[model samples]
Target chain A: MVTAALKEDLPGAGREISIEAVSHRFDLEGAPLPVLDDVSFTIEPGSFVALLGPSGCGKSTLLRLIAGLDHPASGAIRVDGAQVGAPDPSRILVFQDPTLFPWRTVRANVALGLEAQGTLKTEGHRIDAAINLVGLQGFDKAYPHQLSGGMAQRVALARALVNQPNVLLLDEPLGKLDSLTRLAMQTELVRLWQQSGLTAVLVTHDVEEALYLAQRVIVFGPRPAQVVADLTVDLPYPRHRGHPRIAELRHEALRHLGLEASW
Target chain B: MASIELPLEAGRAPAPVQGWTLLAALPWFAAVAVLLLVPDLTYQPLGRELALIWGAVGGVLTLLGLFGNRLGRVGRWSALRGPWLFAIGAASVLWTVVTAKTGWLPQPFFPTPQAMLEVFLYDYGKILHSAAFSIWLLAKGFFFGAIAGFLIGVGMGWSRAVSYWATPLLRYIGPLPATAWLPLAFFIFPSSGSASVFLIAFSTAFPVAVLTWSGIAAVNRDYYEIARTLGASPLFLIVKVAIPSALPHVFVGLFMGLSTSFAVLVVAEMLGVEAGLGWYLQWAQGWAAYANMYAALFVMAAMCSGLITLLFRIRDRVLVWQKGVVRW
Candidate 1:
């Protein structure tokens, strides 16, 4: 049943996302705190891009704007040439915390997007396939509190992919995991993105993680963020961790974030 | 081989000691002995009744002590067995000595335990009828109050405009006791029964509304944002996300409301209602039927505790995830 749903391709599954001159600000105690400053970037369909920055650099805010969870103070976000005004199932955001509804079981949490769109009855098998895709087949009945941090994040990934979203906006989705689990999940993430062929924008503070996974790494400057550097990771799939190229890219990313590149 | 044997030994249950079990039964025996040896100073003829009750209690205690270890994981009662037995026996003996023998407390006001028991045996029909009526009124009031409170709470929490208008009204009216409006309620309603139900409902509604509103309002913003990105409709957000997340608080409200409703139920019933535990209490008080009043009070305590225990069980089932997160 799950295989059939996996084989069934969504219509316009890999639509491109374009953000043109998008800017956003927050009102902090009667003062306007600008977060994003005319941030413009275009992601081709099925590409994995990482938005790397220091803490409080507004990278997460950019992802939120693209997700249509919040609107930009100026400029617009478009998906496949259509202006984005509201949150849609076609683009789902995975947060730093798994944020799986505590009351729901693993299967129910994965089925949330389908249930929200009212297509759960027809696309029910997709939920199973997505859970299977994330390697959570035997944990369908388990509640969120029962899961480990890494397992919970996997469920979150399954929840986003179950919708077969054209673009998956991730905000440090694995930032809370231990080092070993984080490394394992990095591989799992790359595999899921490769299999689904969906565009992904990951926001993270980790330099090596960005270099290890994303096809293109876009570095942002400090608060009132703007794109400071854009580097292409030409390293082959399953890139060697100890490789000099990865180290070089890490140094470059660190330099962009105004940190001293020790190595 | 030695290591495996060590693990096996660790897994095995500790041997049950019989001495503690025997010691636990001693208190119950003492209670029965006290009942048999002591004579009643008052000419109430409560001697046989006290002996019967204490003997039955001792028999039950002895049985429990003998087989408690066989109950396995649920044998927690065995841990405190001796202390519990001693406490119950001491309390029973003290109560009997004071009320029936010594008569330290005066008659009529402090009736013997046997007098209360006689009320249970003879006047049970009346007591039972009154309990039924009270429970019926409670069910009606609670159902209406809970539903109305939940809906209004959801509305106030979800919408700024609703909160803006309703909060002030709630603030002004909610703190006032439910019984305070009894005079007005009696005049407006068609019957005393309706008025009693209204008072119970009104008392219950405030806490439920206030708590539910706060619970909904306090829901993590991340959940709403995440749900929104997943294309959840407004209705789905409320019914699925908001309500479920706020349930722990709703239960808190329900608990507070339940206690308040019970309080209001008694007061409301005392206001010329033809039948109910509260009305029975009033009637008993008028004729100085102290024994009957004690019986009714005991019944009321048991019923209220039973209702509370039932609510806790339901909360445990529905909010199962909150088991380790929040402690009652």
Candidate 2:
């Protein structure tokens, strides 16, 4: 009951994101290696979208660009008609590695965004709320080393949610978790995004995960990555993994990722 | 071993002290008997005092064996050091026999333990004064140097311009011994005290600076990105993310600096300072007062170890999270 009331008071408001002709590259030694090539998409406000691609296909890079942690080499990413120039608290990125500051306890790690925003003094209560939201109620003082992979990622989620970001850019956030934790976190992710009323863009290679969690799964091609397929998961909430529609989507999604989908 | 038994339940009586545990008092009692019954060939000061100390140790160990269960942490600890107490008591008795009672060894050079004990009894005032000076000097130099090194390391780590300039300077200066600059130090500084401080600081700064720089540089790039996306400013990124991430390395640098500071402290005091453990050792050695020199050496050992222990305690407290993480 306490958690329910606290969740309602938590801060977040979904916002629209527009990526137009976005491209990015990295220099290895000397030559330029293009990663994202003219990738463009629009994410409606409060919608859950999963960017499914093969490993190293630049879906994660796209998430980084959306979060404004890094800029695309060319083209504009706008949030509500404002050119995204730098990272803002409104769009928080949860990294694949959790990247929780090892020195900080769970409470301190969750408090980071607010602490940086200078809102910690007034909104310290949000930290406890977010921790409870992640089901880490009794682990506020636990260090990262003391946590399992799933729990650490939960703390990472709590950390990002505490700031109440409008767009949660997950760069394969659950990609490293064990299978069971991965499934559990996938469910929790949908619940968290829906409850927070925030737009979420998850970059993952897991086709089933993409279909299971997101409203729409956008597939990408390899290397200088380009859009390969755009899919809308028409299934209802509490979608079954063994559902006939999910299997069809998985086959189609794998085909787009250059897999045979033999099974 | 008895005390290291499987822990008793809360409010339960502690495991009964073993027979061997009670035997810890045997060596001390033997030492007391040897001191009282053995006739000394040479006059050794503090013979009675030595016997009394051993008698007290034997008495205490006996009491601990009988009633240690009722006591708390201290009692448990003393019980655990049963072997250590026996070894120490036997070693003392052996040393006294070989050096003073038989007069088997050369005189003056191998003064009995009591002769060294006499230094503590009579010359404690001057010796403590020297120890105090050493502590003050070490604290000043190590404190200033460590602070400066930490700042420089952070600068070098965070800013390219600072790193570009500081790297060359650090590479050139960090490896060279701080005492190598003694000539310049003495000439430039206004007083011997300042010169000593500078030398010790120089010794401490190199390791701290190098380590801090490496720590900052090795920080995970994702850490910075995570902080930035959370609406952290550049200042916050450096202070909250980069610094904490690099802390394990910084502590390593601090440790290296602390030990080197001790070496540099002694060298500086011997060369320049009017008072300090090194100066006391040098002064006593000049007068052929080997006992006094040995006493000062003991004091120096205790001081260095004490400071090192303190640093380790701080590192443990500050980097408690780092304990089970990585190589830390």
Candidate 3:
């Protein structure tokens, strides 16, 4: 579904997004419009990638295709060497809102994905383990209304993780948080990712956050967004906020987007 | 410097057993005392037999109240609480016993306690049978109406086609009072007793249906969304989310429906049936047996209070999770 949306945005010709074929027309059309005219990328298993672009750019559209939430009108798409069609448990998507079931307790909400997959006979064990994983111990019976923003989102993370998905798709999951909570969540997310060895793809406009967490940051241009640059941050785990190499990479990525680089 | 001492558990006062117990008995004891004085003080054609019986019952209760238990005790055997209830019960008996003794009070007035107790003791077997019969009718109407209304209301709310087609007809038919359908029910059913039950059942069902539909519609949209996103099947969504979510409102409907059914059953029995409490009251009123009419009326009041209490207990038990949880 995501690939199809990306392909539809590509407009003019059926060229792969990274290749240069800006203008081509269907039968009687006179003008050729470019919206992601050509774009291509490959993501390795067990890798964390951030697709950062300005608003109205097709970066989100691209991630949707990769998540198998949408189909490409014309493009090749594969995950783990198999074609992506429908939403599978292997590729789980988490949205910005926690979307926890209000009626269910925190433990029940966290165990929901597993329940859907019919693996809920072990629900008792899984729920406690997941709640502990997200540092939400002693809150198993708390309702969603009783939780803080960060805590509620932790339940959502636990929900996604309980599915045991190979690929974790985050569509601006922390975009709605206050700055303090967002920073805390980012640190938590990185720690969880490191411990779990889960492959993650985050779609965010927060370039600093992107540079901080992801190993590879793919920059997309303004409109008809294609990969404008690919910068690799080779910082060690538990990266320092004021590291010179991190600052340089942020500057380079911002330079590509025509923005000042200083934090 | 003197050590300042604060009493632990300050302002945690003890329960007022004596006060409540005294308040409870005062009304009944006063009524009985008034009845006992009536024959000697008044020149009315007061029934001598009735006054004697009521005075005896009152004396027994006053004695129990005086010596049965302590004023400050809280248990059932405690003097204060037990006397208050005893006084009230004794007073009710005194009023029924004295109804025939006084012409100052209108016809159908409560008899003096003695007269009511005599009638109760002599005909207790018949009274119990008829009271039991009426209660059975009420239970049947309440259960049938509530269940039918709830299930159909859920159907109407859940299905657009059903709501569009059925609601208009229900609205039209529901407005016509259940009493209005009695003549038809009597004609269709083989017996008047069955007809009264049907009328009560049908009348009770309408409010239940309306309430159930409204309750189901009131469930949060987010619940449905979560269920859908979680890939819940249609059956799971309805049974797990929709029904439980709608239950609180549905219970209100059930209570209302049960009350309506009980009230309608009395009317139905008074009009057509000959065996229920309603019939007994009607029978006594027609014969100018004012004392029996009062007795039956008292029985009916007791039944209504008991049924309402029972329904409330059930509601409390079912919605126990909602205790202390505030919702708008």
On TM-score, the leading prediction is 2
* TM-score of predicted structure 1: 0.92
Candidate 1 residue B113 C-alpha distance from true site, Å: 2.9
Q: Rate the local accuracy (lDDT) of all candidates.
A: 0.86, 0.87, 0.70
Q: Which regions in candidate 3 have their CA more than 4 angstroms from the true location? A: A1-44, A48-103, A114-117, A122-124, A141-151, A167-183, A201-236, A239-263, B1-32, B40-103, B190-201
RMSD of each: 3.5, 2.3, 9.1
Q: Which residue pairs collide, candidate 2?
A: none
TM-score on alpha carbons, each prediction? 0.92, 0.95, 0.71
**Whole-model lDDT for model 1 versus the true structure?**
0.86
Residues A1-263, model 1: lDDT tens digits: 54444656433367788889988999999999999999898988889999999989999999988888889999999999999989988888999999999999999999998998899999898887888888998999999988999999999999998888999999999999999999999998887777777888899999989999999999999989999999999988877788999898888888878886565
Q: Which ten residues in a row have the lowest lDDT in candidate 2 chain B?
A: B1-10
- Indicate whether candidate 1 or candidate 2 has the larger DockQ: 2
Stretches of model 2 off by over 4 angstroms after superposition = A1-7, B1-21, B326-328
Tell me the docking grade of candidate 1: medium
User: For model 3 chain A, where is the 10-residue window of minimal lDDT?
Assistant: A10-19
Return the lDDT, model 1, position B177. Answer: 98
